[model samples]
Target: MDEETFNISMRKFLKKVGVTSQQEIEKAIRAGLANGRLKGDEKLPAKMVLTIGGVDLTFAV
Candidate 1:
């Protein structure tokens, strides 16, 4: 995913999960990684999920 879309989707998910800051998201992601819930080389959720603020660039031309 592009940097802008990744960040925007991350912020939205964080807010939905009750995280309000970058620190919180970072901490959560790190924890997930350590626990094997996330992977060291895997991409972020948005990259797989698709769409940001209703925009889906997967089909963009």
Candidate 2:
């Protein structure tokens, strides 16, 4: 495996995930606020799960 190629691919994937996830979260929050389901100043519990081959990881944010 070419380390440079793998690293570049991984970075691209992560960037796409980050950008799309942020957009989705923002849209959801906006909808929730509009519907009176979420207060503007609330701590929201969020979790992210990543699965790849034999690796499975969960992160709480």
Query: Whole-model Cα lDDT per candidate?
Result: 0.69, 0.88
Number of clashing residue pairs in every model? 0, 0
Q: Put down candidate 2 lDDT per residue, 1-61, tens digits, no spaces.
A: 9999999999999999899999999999999999999989999988776667555654544
The residue pairs found clashing in candidate 1 are: none
TM-scores, in order shown?
0.36, 0.84
Residue 41 lDDT in model 2? Answer: 94
Q: For residues 1-61, could you state the per-residue lDDT of candidate 1 as single tens digits?
A: 6999999998988677554455677888899999999878777754223344656455321
Question: Which TM-score value belongs to model 2?
Answer: 0.84
Q: Residue 52 error for model 1, in Å?
A: 19
Model 1 TM: 0.36
**Model 1: residues with Cα > 4 Å off, grouped in runs:** 1-20, 46-61
Report how far off residue 44 is in candidate 1 (Å): 1.3
Q: Pick the candidate with the highest lDDT.
A: 2
